[model samples]
Target: MPLPLYLLAVAVFAMGTSEFMLAGLLPDIASDLDVSVGTAGMLTSAFAIGMIVGAPLVAALARNWPRRSSLLGFTLAFAAAHAVGSSTTSFPLLFATRVVAALANAGFLAVALTAAAALVAPDKKGRALAVLLSGTTVATIAGVPGGSALGALLGWRAAFWAVAALCLPTALGILKGIPAGRAREQTIGGAALRAELAQLAMPRLILVMLLGALVNAATFAGLTFLAPVVTGTAGLSELWVSVALVLFGIGSFVGATIAGRLSDRNPGAVIAVGGPLLLIGWPALAVLADEPVALLLLVFVQGALSFALGSTLITRVLYEAAGASTMAGSYATAALNVGAAVGPLIAAAALNTGAGSLGPVWSSGFLIAIALLIAFPFRAMIRADSNTEVLQ
Candidate 1:
């Protein structure tokens, strides 16, 4: 609802594009960098590792800074990292740049969400967060496909350059448009913060984080290799792969929107439905690899289910970590990134085994199925949020 939320969305769009565009660019990167495709996939893992570590680390460093300053600082660093990535010709240099970019991305995401929440009324907090997060979904719709097309027409480096250029405007928007709001009060600190964080070790909280990680890992395993999978399985032309990406983005948008709407009233239902749907979608895509129409449709379904699970999973984590809500979101963010990093690593390993393109897809489906089973035993614990202690 606030202009700040929209600005946050823009920041997220730039980050999301940089985060995901690599999937589409992997084929090009591998060839140009003189590495195998499997090796090039480490780019995604490197980015994820950055996020996994950066969210809390950056949040801590900027904990006392003005919200707008933190957001702008992180965004500028993000843009600069992309610029460095665009110029680098070496694989190790490129990998290092991705890690730098991801750290900026993670800091921006953590602060942007906090800033967005600060801008809204208590009743509208969820809606505000949805608006901020929609940037990533919108990135899938526009940035990812657009980056792929640009990479196809120009070069993969061009995609990074474009992302770098896009970030400047977002940084400017944060500076000139969003107000420099005072920091929210730190009601809990020292021993209190330690106690809150310690609750993260509870079985229920651990299970939820594990579930989130597994879902992300499953989704990204196939996603990181989507270019090869579709091209190999459905015999798609380069142009058609972009088209499929658009479809996948559309599904992600729809799924995230639907999940956001249902999150408050029926989080359980969202999980029950989305989890199984993802499990079904992943394997169906693998088994029906030869069917072009099915390939297209399944990608959409997989995208939807993946985000649906993501939305619901975050909600569950917040509930479980009611005593440390802010840190909970950051921790959940890290967990998701952990999955993002590990999933691709596993998929790359499979690809190197000569398991072919379908191997990652099927393997991801199995992981999703395991996540669903894990969810059931923890259902009551996840639902017990109202009884939990508040932070401070």
Candidate 2:
């Protein structure tokens, strides 16, 4: 990894924190701003929608710009958005700020991943990407939790202020650290690149991206509905519910870090392990909800393993989607953005009948089991690479 990589990872950390910490601070925000919880959640949806739209659009628009400049430029825009978000009490004003911030954040993500891949060797791309994505994990473990605590103690506005504060250091870090350069034009431009994407490799790679998205939806569909399930079925205290959420975040962070390393060593093994872990964990999660301690344990592991699959999928896509890694990376991020957007809605629909949220969890469990059967397409693609002969 290079200095540019380190700086980019910092940007990812700040971006991840700004994106997710809002979830933890929602109760405070809604009450303080005189809006309902459902309305404040629009903040989360706004970011995902922006990310979905920006992933491809920004990736294309900035395709020709220097990566370092794009990252620096987008990051500064992101910082300004957060700064604006912190200063506002008006719901509509904050809403507008969130959209702009999210767009900047999305652009930064698409370009940064492409830049990170370019900084490392071919065989090391997985490892390099793992290292990069780990920034998000670090945010899950440290930044989001810390910001949430800060918000709870001070004010919800303080959380956005905290995130906005990071911008100054992040800007200075990226400016000094990221290297200046570009990939070969052949890898980035024109019909030849489109032809490369048309090969069997690219479709399989995008399929892997979709599978990654679906798995996230499957897990979150259940997890998002868990609080209601716990209240109605498990009869847990609000304190324990918060604890459970923390456990899940911790597990996700740990899972991503370990999975990145493992995938770099062998992506097939990580994918193989991730699906079964989710398949087995969800049943235990549902069956043991009565035992708050036990169910939280299972759910933690499930959350962790689910995203470990994501880290591996990242490596696999870059490898298979060669010559157009940036474009492919944009699509992959779009899948994730779509999943994040849709997961809660699916859970809400399943839980709407006053079925104690059990319906959503069961629905999620069944879907993941089906998704496991579909992962073979990606596994087969990676294995195909093993069969190619050395041309030298």
Highest-scoring model, lDDT? 1
CA RMSD of each candidate after superposition: 2.4, 4.3
Q: In candidate 2, where is summed lDDT lowest over 10 consecutive residues?
A: 383-392
In candidate 1, stretches whose alpha carbon ends up further than 4 angstroms from where it belongs are: 1-4, 119-127, 185-188, 384-392
Model 2 alpha-carbon miss at residue 384, Å: 5.8
Q: What is the lDDT of every predicted structure here?
A: 0.82, 0.70
Clash totals for all candidate models: 0, 0
- Top of the candidates by TM-score: 1
Residue 309, candidate 1: C-alpha displacement in angstroms:
1.9
Please give each candidate's TM-score: 0.92, 0.79
